[model samples]
Target: MKKDKPKYKQIIDAAIIVIAENGYHQSQVSKIAKQAGVADGTIYLYFKNKEDILISVFEEKMEVFVENLQQIIEIDASASEKLFKMIENHFSVLASDHHLATVTQLELRQSNLALRLRINTILKNYLILLDSILREGIENGEFEQIIDIRLARQMIFGTIDETTTTWVMNEYKYNLVDLTPKVHRLLLNAIKA
Candidate 1:
């Protein structure tokens, strides 16, 4: 009997767990196959190699993230409200998906330089959205017009990233959603008019 073609997403999901548990360097194809409950050979059918699997995971998750965030930001609302929603969405999504959060925050960063660069490109959309919100705030006189957009973007992204990573590292002992308001406050302090 012919073996079934493995589900690509299932493989990717399993890869996240295996990578998170074992670390990226130690996560072999066989480990992913085992975690995914498919034969080792089945992985080759879906992905060219481990690198392909990692890249696919990032791309797929980010696609969903950008789509949802785009819709939320499009609603008629002030820049501050939009910024709060953006920060909340980012924190909530990752906090809700612990496995994916671990994979992204810890495991994926273990990949070699080339893979890291690709991950950065995939994540650029999120940064762009943050910058757009900052621009809107500046335009509406809600934020300091003289603030450097790039620097403000970095601060926003960096703060959220560090906060999430810290939460993950601590095994998510606290409510991440609660941090959204505080994060929004600090961001506003830095850029607000």
Candidate 2:
């Protein structure tokens, strides 16, 4: 019989905390093992190395995030409204998970080039979803026809990423949800038809 996978998840969760708190360079597998309440050898059972864990964390979380966002966007709504909802949901999800946000926004950047490239591949799915929305907006005449779809997608992702990174750096002192409308306005203005 296959061994249970719950322990792997538990280890990954603990690794997020450890990496977020210690930064990637300082986060050791032994530290993650202790945080996860398992032996160091146990982590190897689930992941080949630290890079694997980091990549897995992003892949798993982002898959769920995209899946949920896709469902939310499918509701009856205008493209503009869908865009707004997507931004709101994106920020809200990250804000709700402080540790994950830190790991993703800051610690993850410290990974080596190969790992960063892997993470980028995982991130493209989310970017593609954003791009699709922009395309829809242009099609529906809600977004300006001349706007470069890729640039618009980059701006949206960059703005939200910067905002969240700022919030995380501030120790999350301010309410992130409160910034949704402002971000939405900035994006809408930049892409409006």
Candidate 3:
């Protein structure tokens, strides 16, 4: 119910900007509230604390990633085509939002181990969706049946994540979306039968 409130999304979006600009350690709850144009106390209505806000940001954004990937799976296409679209979708989502890219790629990784664990748990849904793509590929003879699903998932996710991180680190001077096809090619070559 609280999450369905407009102010909830406002705070989350504001938190992304605040965290991306100020870094997680330097970002304050009041700063997020101010950015959201609400009183500092309003943030408490939806989140338990600053950490909760950070975790919520990941959970909320990851839902979109999972949902989009789900649709890609449903489209009538070969595993290779599906995988290419998945990479393009991933890159496009992050590339289209530089602030979100900064928050997810750089800011989020700066958290403590406990926060990392929580973030990784939120990531599992996205990874599971990726696994479905991989499994479909293997089943349809598009990918090598000898490939281990878990390792293949890790390789694919890790490659996508690291490439995005590198782009962020370089201040996004390059066209990240343009790299999608290249990433897809390398990943496909690695796993394709």
TM-score winner: 3
lDDT of 2: 0.87
Model 2 lDDT tens row, 94-161 = 88899899998898888889998998899998888888888888998999999999888889999999
Model 1 lDDT per residue over 1-193, tens place: 1123448778988998888888888889999999999999988888889998889889888887787778767988988999899889889889888988998888887789999999999999978877888888999999998999999988988898889999999999999889999999988888889
Estimate TM-scores for all models. 0.93, 0.95, 0.98
Candidate that would win on lDDT: 3
Error of 3 at 71 (Å): 0.3
1 versus 2: better TM-score goes to: 2
lDDT of 3 by residue, 1-193 (tens): 8888989999999999999999989999999999999999989999999999999999999898999999999999998998899889999999988989999998888889999999999999889988998989999899999999999999999999999999999999999989988999999999999
Error of 3 at 118 (Å): 1.0
Q: Candidate 3 regions off by >4 Å?
A: none
Model 2 weakest 10-residue run by lDDT: 1-10
